[model samples]
Target: MIHLLYLLALLLCVAPLIPGLLGVVLPAASWLPPLGLNSPSAVAWQQLLSWPGLGESIALSLFTGLGSTLLALLFTFFILRRYWDTPQWRRLENTLSPMLALPHVAFAIGFALLFAPTGWFFRLLAASGLNTDNAINVVQDPYGIGLLIVLAIKETPFLLLMSIGVLQQLQVKRLLAVSTSLGCTHHESWHKVILPLWLPKMRLPLLAVAAYGLSVVDIALFLGPQRPSTFAIQVWHWFNEPDLQLLPRAAAGALLLLAITLSVLLGLRGLEWLLVRGTRAWQLNGPTASTYCGLVSTSHAVNGRYNGAGSPQTLHPALITRLRGCATALRRRIPLFAPFVLIPLLVIPTLLVWSFAQRWRFPDLLPSRYSFRFWEQELEPLLTLTGHSMLLALGSGLIALVLTIGCLEYKQRYHRAIPYWILAIPLVTPQLSLLFGIQVATYWVPGQHFGLWVFWSHLFFVFPYLYLSLEGAWRSYDVRLDQCSRSLGKTAWQTWWQVKRPIVQPAILMGLAVGISVSLAQYLPTQMLGAGRISTITTEAVALASGQDRRVMAIYGLLQGLLPLLFFGLAVFINRRTSRYSSPYSSQGHGPSDTSSTHSGSHHANDTVRG
Candidate 1:
């Protein structure tokens, strides 16, 4: 059974990439058959490169994708430097999960609602008589600025949460103590110590961020700059052209996107090397370096802090500088969760009302009259689709859970684990890019196991999150109790069942919840691999959204958001109710040994404590 699951896991999680990659590659090279034209040609590449707006699209994607990622990184690091272990840190940390929970697409829609030209922001501006016509343009701005900002804000929580592990690893508290003892000012120490430590660890997550920025279709469609659109958008439009002869063009565009992802990734790698491993020069040259220069140079560093202390004690040289960084970071923390959490709330209700209202118009706020008439009409069809969706989500999630557990067990047994880079492949690559090949490989099988194909694809994409969620839990689980069990003559499996599972139950539940939610939210894999036959709430919602109908779009959008939100909530509820397993605010598995044992003073990996 164990080996079977491992094989199934490879089928579900690892194998899909084969075809998904080929699907994109073959066409991108301009050799496709479904639409005819078996012979490959560079015509597709020619057409792709010659598109009038292709240049613009590529540029927009680069700026927005790279721009938003860098912004999120800076914002994440700066915020942590301020609140990490302080009293203010607790409040900030509390905001992370909800912020992380809001899905990208739902957040985009809500962002458009709140900030579009005619959105709530303008509505308020008009009401205030504050040059409403000249109100700040936010949604769908040509530069994708609004899209990037919304994405960044939406992403801040994720970056912040990812940092929780890094901060814990960095031994932030002790690092601060050590630096302060050396006469390093708090702000300077933060810029020097925390950032340097966090950036390297952040590489994979940041790569995931960069890839999402580059390939995001749904969010960009809703809010990205469209005058030229981004490369991802162009590839999407090309793929949707419905012309078999033009398949190569679409393929070439996919190839272009793939190339762009690689380039940007390489660029980030280059940037990392420059910032970290590449040079020790700048770091050694910073003011903090003076501390290492001994007592005399410390005097010089002292003067850097006090141009003139006591201006306001807010002008207290060292005090004020530290406060400034912390206070600014602290401010971002409070409202961080509010908009992130509340937007999902708004989307759920609005979409629910929308799905039911037949002729509901805008500007009136609430639906004038409500009816389940649409539900009555669509229920049977929607139910079948929902059945398909549920089966896939549940199946993929459980399979993912088993594989995740196996990998975890493997690590515990051998202290060897899959490299994070390998695990993050699905997260870091474009889903469309990855699935392009897998989709073809599926067709290669010459069978009608579309449901199985789709289920496996969903599992492929979702396992990382499930695995990540459980990794910390498994690590933090106490081994001493298991040893006791062994001493009492219980076998390993028995030990895991009776002792290990209970303590880490919350993490398991949380991992399951996350896995299920990710499965529920899959769009690209389902649509592409299912060949338009399988319709989940996401594919349906996305399709309906394309119609641009306020009422109908909102309706589908709500269902799309609700399905995962429901699962995510249940997971959280179970996790919380199963308290004593782990604290809600607690990082995964923080055994005291984490701090005292390996890498003491290393707040860079806060999760070690969670263990």
Candidate 2:
């Protein structure tokens, strides 16, 4: 049974990748028989490399991708190191879900509203008597700085969220206590102790960020440079060119883009190895090596905060003084999360204003006039598209959830799982590289079921994230409960249904929400597979963004953001309710065990009634 389920998962999740990749690979090799290029050759590669400004585009991609990834990593670690156990962390943690729930394309639109040359910032400058005519344009800056900054800001929240699971597993309080007791300052301890440990565990999330930075298309299309564009955008244009002869060049470009993405991923992994393994001298040197840094006093370094036991009996003057400084620094930098957290806050209102504005020209602090005309005009089409988007998201998310639970349960039963690298192929592989082949594969079917194709494509992409989200919970689940239920004469299905599901239902809900969000955010897959016939909210929004109708774009952006926010909000509410109901004292003042036995008794009663 487990073997069949494993095979089904692989078929659902990993099989599409083969055809998707081969679709591009064959054309890149000049073997597209349909195009009459029967003989394989390197002509396509030569043409791709010879394109004007190709080198500049590749350079821009590398700089933006690598730079944004490293910067976000630094910011995430700094924030975690300073405020992991501090009071400010609670506030920071609260904002992560909403910030994450906002889809990337909507965020890009909002970012442009704030930073464009004629955007809010420039308008503020104009109102303040500052010259606005010569202001720099960051939305599509030629150097890709705008794209880099936006990617870093958008990705930091995700990295921070991933770190939550890691830190919990690491037992951070004990680790900090042990390091500080060994004569290390907070600065020294995090850099020399925690960082090395954290980096190794954070490898996959970092790789995901880097991969995204390298291959992002929707955000790049909205905000990245236009003249040469990033490599991904360039490849995108080529793939969509009217002339079929140029398909090979596009295929070659996709392959090259894939190569670049893999290289960046490998480079990040190598950097991690160098820091954690290849060069260990810096980590193992000594606590006294950098103890006297301005962050920590000598007496504090010697006496330490507490012994390895993590108690707080002794408190010295130097320790007190340095601790105050650390707290102050933490408080100071804690506001850095504001701009990231505030983007959605500010952008939503700005979008709301724009959606209603009839004439809000540049340099105007507020809209000159407002009307409901845009909303009224778009209401019907908007409803239809939103319905399609929701249907796709719901169908794909639920299917992905079921498959993920099956795979994880199989792993639990067998104590073996698919390798992370294999699972991550759908994630780390550039969509441009695979989507072309997947698109072609859709052609061989007898009929064009655009909705079905889009649904399957969404399922393919959403499965990995849903599976990854549930993996930690599934692995950490205590199988003892399963055994106990079985020993009570329950079948495997009964044990899982009555015992295991209730305990991990919160995680399952969260995974479902995440998968839905992922499906909602998809732009390339919907466009490629839907073949311009189906219009989801994302497809409609991207098309409108190209036009100058800011009001319409804002409506779409807000709506695009609204669906995921609604689902995530639902997940949070359900999770809280589950926690309350599952609490030891929440069962009409009954104990936790009594509540469980009561649930079990009810389950048995229902089974007996059915029998």
Worst 10 residues of 1 by lDDT: 594-603
Model 1 clashing-pair count: 39
Q: Candidate 2 vs. truth: CA RMSD? A: 7.9
- Among all candidates shown, the one with the greatest TM-score: 2
Q: What ranges in model 2 sit over 4 Å off?
A: 1-4, 288-290, 293-334, 583-611
TM-scores of the models, in the order given = 0.83, 0.88
The superposed Cα distance between candidate 2 and the true structure at residue 319, in angstroms, equals 22
> For model 1, how does the per-residue alpha-carbon lDDT over 1-611 read when each residue is reduced to its tens digit?
55555556666666656667778788777666765767877788888778898778988999899999998887776677666676655655654554455566666665666666655556556666667666668776888898788777777667776776766667888888877776677786786666678788888778888998989887777688777888888887777777667767877777778889989999998998787766566555556545456655554454344336533211356765786678687777664345544654565555565566665343444457877776676668677767887888899888788897887777776687767766778888887677776765665576698788788788887787777777766766667877899999999889887777666665666567677777877888888878888888677766765546655566556665666657656755654455545433243433422221111011122243354
What is the RMSD, in Å, between candidate 1 and the native fold over all Cα?
6.2
Q: Which residue pairs of candidate 2 clash?
A: none
Q: CA lDDT, every prediction? A: 0.69, 0.79
